[model samples]
Target: MKKIILLLTATLLSTGVFAQVKTPQPSPTSKIEQVIGLTDVTVSYSRPSMRERTVFGSLVPFGKLWRTGANENTKITFSDDVKINGSDLKKGTYAIFTKPTKENWEVIFYSDVNNWGTPQKWDDAKVALKTTAKVGTLPMKVETFTIMFSDFKMDSAKLNFIWESTEAMLDIEVPSKKIAEESIQKTLAGPTANDYYQAAVFYKETGKIDMAKEYIDKAVTMRKEPAFWYHRQQSLIYAEMGNKEKAIEAAKKSLELAEKAGNADYVKMNKDSLKEWGS
Candidate 1:
């Protein structure tokens, strides 16, 4: 009896391990990433097949909020702020929900993205942006639900949702021109004061006293307000150039500014340099 019980327990354990089955999900998850202009957009959702059944009106009822996908909430992420149907949306991840109708679909970007399907408790305040997209009849039937970007442009694109023979499109606009212009302006504006200071320090370290003096002078003149570190670097450059008067003058200014800014390190450094230069 004991041997028979042990054999039965071993059989059951082996069966439990071997009986686990893996099969294709009825609705498979899909993810797509796109770059429109300077922004990166990503969509993650589950795809459900029609399986010869009617979609849209019947399977997915009209005048109701949909998860926009099968199992989990459909999520869309943006690398930069974007405009959808003339409404501004911040840069972040959002769950996409929708209400379908024969003429149009109300697409919603929801702030909360942790729900399994539609939220049990819908909060209007959680709705980031809601826009209506006109429904169009597709020439060919789409067996599986699809979400994709179309009509690509440098600053704009269309987010298309197609299922069966119905299609809906949302226009997305990115700040490509604004970003590009800002970048161009910054590049064309010439180096900053810190750039000159760093160049001066590099030149000084490389034993190029002339270039160091030129850069340090430019750095000092560019500042609208006095910076102790900049003046300190200037003093060092002048001292290296064998100009005791200018070095002492710059060290004195650095000492004053450092004292005002409550920087003990710079104050001590400037005082030591001043004493060394016979100030």
Candidate 2:
């Protein structure tokens, strides 16, 4: 009797160890992190494949609140405040729920981020943002559930949900103009060495030779260890100013630095410029 009990315990332990072996999941998890303008957007969800079965109205019923993905609810996070479907949405992570219909889809962003399947006790108080997106028919059937961004601009894009033959879209907008203007103001107020160098390059291209020379001189002085590229810019500025002596001097300095750095491209560029300038 003692031997039998020991054998039974060993068999149960072996079965538990074998069960720990991993296998392919029916629905796989996916994560996406994307940056739009100055904002960071992240999405986490599970993708379920269609095994030659109808999805929209059959596998997933119409006019019912869906968790938006298999297992845990789909999550979307925003680093900054944004607009969804022209409605204000604060910055944070939210559980995305959906209600599909033939004409339009109701997209809900719920404050509750932890839940399994549908919220058993649905709470309207937990709702953060709710909007509607028009449903469209796709040309071809999609075998797996997909969420993607499209029609991207500097400040805005469209989030698309696709499954089977239906597509739902939501417009997302960020404050790109405010961020850009603030960045420009901050840069112009207290410019860095690289900023001065970029301004010099811009001025040189725009036929402002005097400003180019001034900014380049400031860049050379401000930098702790100026690179070969900076000397190359100085050489170009001097050459454009019709100062052949200074151009030759700057080109020689650039060639020496490039050779020390083992940068074959810059070496060739300096050699070509020196030959052109008779340095």
Candidate 3:
């Protein structure tokens, strides 16, 4: 009989421990995974769709840190080195945290990737990135923290991380075209640097003039490149800055580069630009 009672007590204790623990919630809506270089990061969570109560202080409250996602910490997994808003993040998992407000917010990439909601695991040293709040018009209250890309370029893109109140923007670049251009200028400049013209094309199209200039100079310096490639790129930058004279000169250079390089296609393009300007 004593054995039976002891067994019953043991069983009850085991049940109690489990009863106090909560189970992980089933999958909900919204999922996003980003490849920062080679590593894969996943974000899976849900959000309440238009709660009956007012969502402000009464529900989510203000001036309080909220788990940006529906359950646990909004998770960010890094597969490779990431530069989040100029701050470097080593590969790892991190708990994403956000400070909510009516019109602004503070986002946190906490080091402690594992934790429950509300009071989170915040290791100061582990913070990989933190971004200042940005004010923008969001048409709807996003249920979960979400990231989307826009303004694409060869080496970088704008990542818009959005939630209630406001959103933040970060430059996501892989193998960093900025660095790549500098590398080319430093090591690849010489005759036929035009071979590296693809890198310059991306920089110019993406509105990175300083970067484009550095690379284009290398290409032009290559075997006295027809002013074509060099002049053309300069024109693009001048147009961007609304400088007509520099743009005209650049057009002339493009024609020269093309004729010298024996690329008839480029010369025709520059000729058209000059004709349009009646020059």
**Top lDDT: which candidate number?**
1
* Per-residue accuracy of model 2 over 1-279 as CA lDDT, tens digit each: 999999999999999999999999888999989888788999999999889998988888899998887989899999999999999999999999999988989999999988998788999999999999878999999998988888889999999999999999999999988988999998787988898899999999999999999999899888899688998999999999999899888888889999999999989999999999886
Provide the global lDDT of candidate 2 against the true structure.
0.92
What clash count goes with each model?
Answer: 0, 0, 10
Candidate 3 per-residue lDDT over residues 91-192, each given as its tens digit: 677776776666666778777766778553446787668775554767767654455665655555566766554465666555555555776896764445
Q: Which sections of candidate 3 miss by over 4 Å? A: 1-29, 36-39, 56-58, 119-122, 139-147, 161-168, 176-279
lDDT of each: 0.96, 0.92, 0.66
Weakest ten-residue segment in model 3 by summed lDDT: 47-56
Off by over 4 Å in 1: 1-22, 194-279
Indicate the worst ten consecutive residues by lDDT in candidate 2.
186-195
The worst-scoring run of ten residues by lDDT in candidate 1 lies at: 14-23
Q: List the candidates ranked by TM-score, beginning with the highest.
A: 1, 2, 3
Model 2 segments more than 4 A misplaced: 1-16, 191-279
**In terms of TM-score, which candidate is stronger, 1 or 2?**
1
Native RMSD of candidate 2 (Å): 13.4
Q: What is the lDDT of residue 33 in candidate 3?
A: 76
TM-score of each: 0.72, 0.64, 0.46
Q: lDDT-based ranking, best first?
A: 1, 2, 3
